[model samples]
Target: MKPILLLFIFVSTLFATQYSVIISKKVDVGTLSAQQVRDIFLQKRHSLGNQKIIPLNLVGQEPSRIAFETDVLGMGRDRLNTYWIKQHFQGITPPITQPSHESIKAFVQNVEGAIGYIPSSMVDNSVKVLYEF
Candidate 1:
């Protein structure tokens, strides 16, 4: 390979963060479309077939959250905030939150029906990736 190509690849790899939606190995969900994942996170739809779905979220101004919101949920922070506020009045609320990707993975691994997103590179045998962004 050419040196320029090699350098470009290295730089991109260093800066880029690939994110994915993941679930506990125990959850029986199949691959989900972006829309389905968005619904789950937004609390608009719950359960996939027989299994109940519990979505996890990263807290406040997180880069992973920003990317996931933009790429998958197709909403900005302001829009999401307004949405949740309206839902709140009707007794609906946002998903549970964890502080970091490591916490998210651990939560998914141990909690049945638990699902969340994190950096794609953080995934391991403990969790099943349902969608990527």
Candidate 2:
């Protein structure tokens, strides 16, 4: 019984996902409120002060994407898909999608005003992390 419990804990830790919200180092906005992060991702708010903000999303089916949507965006996959579809009808668009965490890091590093969430393990000095979850 103790062995089974230990295995369960190990497996749970192995599959756990940690996410960090990152912005270009050039972006002057320091840290952001959780609400602000949600708004940015949802396209409710665009620019932070004078700097134009661009949010990026990981491709569908990525665990980090799942975590970010569930935790930060406060929406599940089905609801988020529905929301974007409705926005498309209104001529509003969702954030650009990157295929991987590495791609997101590279893009955020090179693009001013870009923001994205990636696995906390992938973070480095190239971008500034604004929040973590």
TM-scores vs. true structure, each candidate: 0.88, 0.87
Tens-place lDDT per residue, model 1, 14-107, is 8899998999888777899999999999998889888888899999989989999888999999999999999999999899999988998898
Q: List the RMSD of every prediction in angstroms.
A: 3.5, 2.4
76: Cα error in model 2, Å: 0.8
What is the lDDT for 102 in model 1? 91
Report the number of clashing residue pairs per model.
Answer: 0, 0
The ten-residue window of minimal lDDT in model 1 covers 20-29
Q: Which residue pairs does candidate 1 place in steric collision?
A: none
Candidate 2, residues 1-133: lDDT per residue as tens digits? 9999999999998878778999988888788888999999999999999999899999879888888898999999999999999999998999999999888889899999889988889888878989998
* Clash tally for model 2: 0
